[model samples]
Target: MGDEIRTILEQYALQNAVKHQDVPRAGAVIGAILGKHAELRSRAKELNAIIGSVLAGVEALTHEEREARLAEIAPDLIASMHEKREKSSDLPPLPDAEGGVVMRFAPNPSGPLHLGHARASILNDYYVRRYGGSYIYRIEDTDPKRVVPEAYEMVREDLEWLGIAISDIVYQSDRLGIYYEYARRIIGIGGAYVCTCEAERFRELKLAKKACPCRDLTVEENLLRWEQMLDGTFIEGEATVRIRTEIDHPDPAIRDFSAMRIVNTTLHPRVDATVYPLMNFSVAIDDHLLGMTHVIRGKDHIANTRRQKYIFDYFGWKPPHYLHYGRMSIEGLVLSTSSMHQGIADGTFTGWDDIRLGTLRAMARRGIRPEAVRAAVIEIGCGGTDISFSWDNLFAKNRELIDKGSDRYFFVQDPVHLTVKDGPEQTAHAPLYPGDEERGYRTITFNGEILIPGKEMEGNDLIRLKDLFNIRVTGENTAVYAGDSLTEIRAAKGPIIQWLPPDQTVPCRILTPEGIISGVCEAGVAGCVGETIQFERFGFVRIDAVADGCVTAYFTHR
Candidate 1:
């Protein structure tokens, strides 16, 4: 038991050191050990000693030495850790994906794609790539009333930005003729019928498990009614073609679902044909015709899946393999397209790309990386229970990817001038990225004055200028040199504050989730539009615009 506890503690400590260049937290190590071996819970005192010894040994080694030791002692453990990390973001292989598999991301062009929509798109893309299958981007624009003319292009752009390669682009509006032919065939085969009953009467009959008079109509009569539906004999809501299903089915929704309906074509954005096939009917036919071997979507559409299966059975065609995942909701984010459109119309929101919203465009504008979004969604995978997460969860993932590449710079918000008395004129060089010497550094000359944030000066009598000398704050706006000895600074344990030389600073503003913050940054920030960088001791920000001696950026995360 003692040997096993030591081994687990060492593995965790080595993992932490390799990733974070630090020893594992004592509490975390203990918790992990207890989790792996419940029997050890009763032996906490014994386990703590072993864990402490392992952590002590790990902390004593330099980062390079720790890594080297880990590699020498357990190279397989390191490999296994990498494999686990990779597999966490990977999707399970599709069952019976024989022959070539085809999948699609079908989105209605009523609004821009949000994070919820990206889950389906990324999942399909991931599996298709994994199994050497084909992916399609099908725009479901059958509903003309709600469709946005620009939404189609926006969805395409979002997909491209997300790095999802689509093999084919299809518009459901363009395939109306194919749907019409299928509808007619279903009617001819007595698999569906045109019902002209009043809306309320049809509902009453369906609820009572009784078919309306139109359900038993002859094939010729149904065909005639279907032609009338096409030639303006019927107006919207007056007639609909419903597929024949078991009236005695346990679920009322499964009984004779509508396949095609009379739509006001004049209200539609793209097509003028009066007859429009409903979602389930059109999608079922499209999947079969397009050779989609796998269908990945949310579990809320389980009823729709049952409806679509009837169509497949009627046509004697094989249904695609279904993979339904739960709906994903991000806390405090409004993902409803209708709500977003209403908010925009009422001036509640600036636009689709408003930072407060959850649209993909908004995330992009806020400096969230596309890879981060992909990783977050893939980690959730395809599960049946609904999953809800907070913005902090996503920001943590973004920080991991952004921290290594984002160059660090000083930003003084509400700047206060600090005068350093008896300070020598010196040139301070700071690396763009720590531990990456190849990237080089930026230089700022400090003679006697610099700008620091006003809020950081409240509780400090002594402070160290990061990567520079130390100072003793004797007054609100005055400080004196305190020597450059590393031992003295470490012993003092004063706050290390970031400063900006006034001569080489540029006006800057950061748009955060809470509000906009105005500040000044290093002059090197100029011409860094569309680049992501970390404001020293502040947060990661993406430069949005650069002009008029001011740099505008959006705060991504801390």
Candidate 2:
């Protein structure tokens, strides 16, 4: 029985306990899955029967050594175990730790993962934990023209960074032969036929304005044509295996759509097969074979579902539940797949992780957490007809789910010196962010030494930090010889240039898509990689990467 029955029992018990003003037993089943009070009261009789059954089942297990019996006869026990197996291979030693839910995050490796893909990945991860199921990672690299090697790597890396691990990794390309065989079987059953009509001609035929010359061919003839097409006997695009459907079908996508095609150009990544099977055909067959109970994908493929359903109907197999979501569109930006591919080819965007391209890896590089990305996507939600998405709103939603952690020191640009007077004669410890009591603060040492062109120190005054610091003016202009010139400078009072001791500071060089940038930081702060915080006296900065003697940092300025 569904969990609804258990919920119903719980509700009944709660109501009874509330009315009687008595403590409810912890082990007592009480909860209502349905609505209303009288209706729930009336269902108590049925609930009693369920409880009796549950008790009897438990009683039967009492003799087989409590543990074995409880496991064997408990209601929903088997189903729960299966769910647990999917989420994680290891069954938690503690009963409370075991969760049974199965989820999969399938992404097309056509391009870099964007916010949408991250959302799907997060949802899959969330549900697996919520329901106690296993998470699977499947590559939907069926479209050879769109799939790229870098995209596959990026999808894996981004998810890994998000701490989402899959129990198994499967690819649709590996199942092309099965799809081709199914297509052939459909042809043998007269459920499919081969069409040699060109694009415009096919459209005309689909529109019922023209007749397809190959439409009336017999099953035998169609089978021979299909086999020839698959074996490369037919020229590319000359013959396509089309499912036999009513010509006047309301949905154009379901009308004799291509099941298999002659794609002899390049090798299929997963299959290495010369011939390419249509996505609709391959996905339907693989989903079934892979034991996928649900198919979650972009709503753009909703139309394809009908065609896939027809294939499943011809095969007499139950199709998985489909959850089609709206495409994650970023506002003010035209995310053209063709243009993105072109950009990758032409080096317009550095790599797939170029922040400007809306790639997940790029977002990760920019310090966007995967959970934040997912929360943003879910806030957008699914089931809406096509609508332009607002990226500003997406980020705004992300802020709701992600915690804005304590700030850290971020140096953004060229250094500015500030002189201070009447402040602390010694160094002052500055907090990274006020109110962040846990994070404490980093110390900035003030040695009472101010560098001015030529200046002398007197009493209390303010020393402005060109852009960063304002310290107390301590001394007058002192002559400092640089190379061959002796320049006179004044000591202004403001914030002092609080830098790490020379021994404590380490030289850092940042490599970005633009070029190389150099800076210095204490080794203690090197662990702040992937953090989004500003450096004191510096511009906004993010810890993109950290390596031994080599770190990559992104700067908003040149």
Candidate 3:
């Protein structure tokens, strides 16, 4: 036996060893085994208790009213079910220390990691790190057309950006043989079969509320057809592997569905290897083989979970703990991965981070922090698959979280000119953002050359720099408007605003993944490259990159 098993045996044997009635010599030998096998003995006792309880429960359930009793105690059932609940307080904790917790962040790699992806990735990374568990980075690139190297690269970049380090990168493409093996095993178990019905026929069957003819194929024929599909004898869409399941199970998803199909495309990232090409079957097998302990993903995939559980049952592998969370959606739009990619290409969105796209990356670019998004997901919880989202609700959550700690900056849409006549031009200054106790004020010089909001500023007396001192304007020598600044200035009715000194070195352009955006203030003051900050009046800004005396930033409109 291996050291771990041997040590375990010894420890358990020592603890439960026969008591010595003979002498001290016998006692010493038993004591030695007890010392070595103490841990296993404890584990054995715990396992025995659990087994006994389960057996007793089964025996009791054979009698009547068992369901009623279970229902009565169901509230406390999960609470009583314990494995381990140790929480890691740091990012990237050791995997082995976490009671063998294994986590995976599987991204489709169709586009960049959005806010949703970031949240999911971070959660998995954190949990795995905390428990000292293995954090596996898996590429869910089963779809041929959607899988792109750029998308995969961006996934890696986004994670590194957020300080998440993943080991054991596994691709679904590399594990096709394992998936096919499991599929054959499942078919042998009579849980899967080959279907020759066309797509429309299956649709008609669903609409007519009946099972398709291909649903009852014999195991031998089905296996032969599966081989034919692999050998290219069966044309694409001509045949598919469908899992045998109940049709009238109340839920439409439980109805027999295709497990594998030929998409007839060589563009797949993994297609170069000429292997199996379906998502559900590949995921089901790969997850089991990888020893995934829990599957945390969007609720939209919950339907797939039922089918996957069936696969797990057919293979005699325990289905992992499945945790479904809400997807990022908006009114009049579905957050489908295909749709998002189309939006990116069609200019319906600038890119994945397009604030209007409702993508997680777009959400992040639009000023929604990763933490805020996760909190929102938690608040929304998981509600089946179908969900109707309102942009207002998500914005409200973001606004609440951002308003607390983020500072604000001033951004005048149309800046004007004002030549103050003989004025007492004291320097006006204000904090970079409101409610910032630690941030000192930024000073702006009036210097008899104040760019107030009007061309005809002869009659105007005061020039308020906003949150700073209100300066008294002297006479003007021929005032001229800059043509860009707002000309019409009303009488003061509210607090004046703040402005950066014209001489301050501010970034000019902030380029983001979404698109290019002009920067207003100093590069560091507004935001650093790849950093997020709130512009006082213009909403959130993400600093993309910096170049010769210019910085690229994307404005996330409020």
Candidate 4:
């Protein structure tokens, strides 16, 4: 099996090498192999070692040798090596996307958007971008119980921050009349009826595959009841309009699901409403009316899709192409809106932008790029398999996007003063981007004193003070300047650490998901408010504010 896998691996390696006109990228080769044969993921370590050996051998060969070798191993691949790469690796193409496509991200204005919401919105936005089309932002705020008055705008702000431009803005609350028209039409067609049956009684008959007394009501009679429902004669819980379906359907919940229910107008924050349409009904009506060509959502909506289809079938409307992705559980973050709200109310969190939360606002505060979020979710793709996502994927993407562009600084947390006995009073010059001197540099003057991270500062340890002189730890909170040679420090095999000139430092505090890390950075970072910068020997951070000569930042990631 190893030999067989190795031979196949070699084919891809050679193909990749020849295509690039250089050594093959291990990531591309490995991605190609595992993408096709996922069962071998359990042997990733073994596979990596084998790929390393294969890459070495392939690297030694010239481009011509690689092409000839690939021809012998897999003759058919050589022809397509120069051809354009397939779009299959990206989000799968929308089915029936020929004459352009219309899509929407209908988020209920319940609270701010979180990472879970990003998956659906990103996929929809991705398809809309792939084929130029109108993307609608629909706010499903009809259910007044779930509506947050402020959330109506917060959702838009969050989406905009994620770089999604809304071509059309829709509010379901403003479309009650449209829903009422459809409800009337369906009732006139005998596809729906108003039921005065008690909630428990309907559930009992639905379980028995039996119809309630309302099932036999005439269209005129149901319309009268619907009017009564609309006129507030039938208060909340007395009557609900239910769409007609086969009572004996395998899924009991699908049998005559509620379409519209009565609710008091005062309970709503935005608009006065006597009747509220259920989620599936409102969604189906909006999707059809808005001319949606595709519906991308989570698998949890499968039952809702089945229920919504009854409306489509009744109205003789062609349902959009519905695609459902599996559940993706984000690790180490809470997506519960209620918890977040309560935390804010009780002072457990600062606000919606708390680092501990999983809202997009929180991510932005921590300097995680919108592109990284989209790329991370897109890499997850629209697969119907439950995925357990770790933050490593998102952090890696964010690091790739922000690494080189970010200027570097020095921050020493829990700083201890290291008095270097023989250090000179000289200025230290460090490039804003290491090895990119053309970008410019920042200078820090030292008076033979520096602040270093107190962690693991052992006595007699030869340490490189980063771009400054080398030092030997003499005792607790004390060190002697040993030498100023990069080669000498490298040869000494000592730890290299970041230092801040005590006289020219700014008080700094970095807010992380866990807690606050208070430290001091160079004076230059004071002017870097709103910029993402890397702190030497520390993680990347976004400078949130610099006030009163103190710097406050949010930790992006390592």
- Give the distance in Å from residue 459's predicted Cα in candidate 3 to where it truly belongs: 14
Which residue segments of model 2 deviate by more than 4 Å? 1-103, 132-135, 332-338, 385-407, 410-426, 433-532, 536-540, 545-552, 555-558
**TM-score sort, best first:** 1, 4, 3, 2
Cα deviation of 358, candidate 1, in Å: 2.2
Candidate 1 stretches greater than 4 Å from native: 1-85, 88-90, 389-404, 486-492
What are the Cα lDDT values of the candidates? 0.84, 0.58, 0.58, 0.86
Which number leads on lDDT?
4
Cα TM-score of candidate 4 = 0.82
lDDT string for model 4 (316-353, tens) is 99999999999999877778999998999999999889
Candidate 2, residue 16: the lDDT equals 34
Regions more than 4 Å wrong, model 3:
1-98, 123-126, 129-132, 165-167, 206-211, 273-277, 326-336, 346-350, 353-410, 428-443, 453-463, 467-494, 499-552, 556-558
lDDT of 2: 0.58
lDDT of 1 by residue, 51-102 (tens): 7667766754544456567777779866665453554566777887855689
- lDDT: worst 10-residue window of model 4: 81-90
Local accuracy of candidate 2 as per-residue lDDT tens digits, 136-243: 797878777777777778778777877786888887777777777887899988888888888788988788834477878898999888788766788777888888
**Model 3 C-alpha RMSD to native:** 23.4
